[model samples]
Target: MKLKLISSIFILLGYNSFAQNAKTDLSDSLVKDKQVILAKYVPMANGEYLYKGYQIPIDSFINRVNDFRADFNAQIAKDKLSDLSILKEKDVMFYSYNVLAHYQIYYGMDSVGMENFGKVVQEKRGEPNFYKLIDSAQKKAFPKRLSNDERKRLDDIIRKSTDLNDAALFKTSAAYRTWLNDYLKGVQRKKYLADTALGYGGDNVAMLKVIAAEISDPFIKEYLLYTFTGTVIKSVKNAGAKESAYKDFMAGTTNETYKKGIMEIYINYKNMSSNAVSPDFNYTDINGKLVSLKSLRGKYVYIDVWATWCGPCKAEIPFLTKIENDYHDKNIHFVSLSVDRMADKAKWISYVNDNKLQGIQLMADKDFSSDFVKKYNINSIPRFILIDPTGKIVSGDAKRPSDPALRKQFDSLLK
Candidate 1:
């Protein structure tokens, strides 16, 4: 009887182990499938895809894009691509369309191909073959018919050309400007839109700034400059002061050289305050002890704003660890604050421990809404903020450790 019981127990254990392995295999298969699909659609030259005039190496771009495509495909595979769903089918369509736009912008479609692509997207006013799958998904997903406004927005975007300089032949016609504004307004009506909507953030901001700086039209250039300055560095608390400085900077600037000059000015401004006023913050350390930035005021403070899920942030850990080791006795303090949601505390702590980071690790319980982040105007991650001994603003544009000059600066500063 004992022997029979032992054999039965072994059988059950084997079945359980097999089931777990199968589950893991299935998950990996889905991930691999998504990668294959993206690779097929977005072919890279030497494993790099250039977008918006930026050359993104294949490995880096693929790493970032794969997550987005996988989440999108997962929703589609699960038949959840409805209008009310968080991952709406329209979003996928827009993403694909935007990717194609970037691809065209970087690669430059042949004259004939460009003309034909524009004609089919615009004059036809029907679903193009490439977007048929997305269209079908949208129709099934949306219970009510698409609003006229929504349809018009999609049509306009589809008809838009990748060529930015061809004013007469471009997709966002003079008339479409009004439509674009209305579309942005409608998006605001939604609870919250992603940063990519209407190119509010992401590469669009950089692209527009570059164009504004290079364009010969004084009025257009000024407008773009205003938009860039307003969005990038304008703070309500210091508005009048910043504006006065900006006006003085722009007084003698002409359209011909204004863009390049302003870019230089901005870079200088960023560098000027690179190691400035230490921002005050409170966070819980890995041991669940509350730590305050004020306590570290006497020493050189290296504050890194990052998150557990941020890939770039994870990649920088090794370099950061090395810096911490080198500067351990230089009266310098290193602190890494994670901006992950409060619910992710466990994951944040686990990541810090797993990475064996020597620097002080803390969790930004308030996440992006943290007062320090708002004060710093932190829109992106892997940001390094250095605070000098006296707590006054010094240099704000400290280069990454990877840069030779930055390493030299660090070595000098430590000395």
Candidate 2:
């Protein structure tokens, strides 16, 4: 009876050991799978290095990454100490908090408790704080500096406001107006400096002429007139024209000189426009057939200037495809011109195929410097330009096809 009992106990122990080993094996397999998933999605350096060059396992590194991103997004959405506490253990929490604070301030949600969040944000400026991080990012992104005058203006508005709502309203109004005024002033200054340095000829002359017509500010108008007059005087000297003629032109009333300068600028701009037509472009289509813009002149054309890497451009493609399908019977032609470099041609083509772009897909081998981009003055994308049947520009600022109103307009035009 004792021997039988001992044998039964040994059997039970063996069973328990097997179960434990099985559980351990399952856990190890799950961990390996998770690591593979992380390696596939997250950017891994040397398959070993992790955040900021720290060497860690792919699974562990990705967990931290996901945790950091989630905490940062949460703080932005929920601007409170409790939400921030989620990232308390993170070393990079300060940077994430700063971003969250700026986002809150921008959306006017930072005033949940503080009456004037914008003022607080401004006053709280300095490195290691939230506002400074935002400011640093802005400086890196934009070419223009925040002028002292503009800062003073913002400060005055903040000082006047006793509550968040008042401060937000004041900022919304004053900030927009100040931006417009400063933009006009900056453009005028740039034109004058460019003219002085590069001479009032070539591209500078063309650009100055365009600016003269487009600008509406009185101070900018006066500055442009004076600069043009100075240029004309220099031109006369270079041409060896009589000094008397130069004096005669200079002696005229500022108003008359301004009018003449404006006219001259307009004429020059017109000439430049005439000479700036998009050059004949040749790019292989999906089927490896060469296509050119000059060949598609008879039909109304819609050009989509975009790059594969541009998220906005990618988002608009589905809408563009829908528009193309809806207007297939019409004489309108849709073209997607990609500014992705030639090296990325295969990838571009793959994306077009994968997304099934209905419109004609063409690559700009020279990328951003492509002649069509320069002709259209495309500073940002996804830009849409419509050319009428007669070849004149129908609308330089055509809306994205996702806009229902724009789609309606296109349908009417087709009819």
As a whole number from 0 to 100, the lDDT of residue 390 in candidate 2 is: 58
Clash numbers, per candidate: 13, 1
Measured by TM-score, the strongest candidate is 1
TM-scores, each model vs. reference: 0.44, 0.39
Model 2, 1-415: lDDT tens digits are: 2232222222322211111000011111101122233345343445432222222333353355456546445544553665333322231322223222222122211112222322333333322575554444333322232345643543343233222122222222333222333333434455544334434233323334544565555544444434544344323222222233234434643666455643443343233345334345787777788898778887778888787766456656667777888889898889888887789888988988987887788887677666655544344567777776656666654778767777777777777
- Write the residue-wise lDDT of candidate 1 on 293-345 in tens digits: 88777877777778876645655666777777877888788888888889988
Those runs of model 2 whose alpha carbons end farther than 4 Å from true positions after fitting are 1-279
What 10-residue stretch in candidate 1 is worst by lDDT? 17-26
- Candidate 1 yields a Cα-based lDDT of 0.49
**TM-score (C-alpha, index-matched) for candidate 2:** 0.39
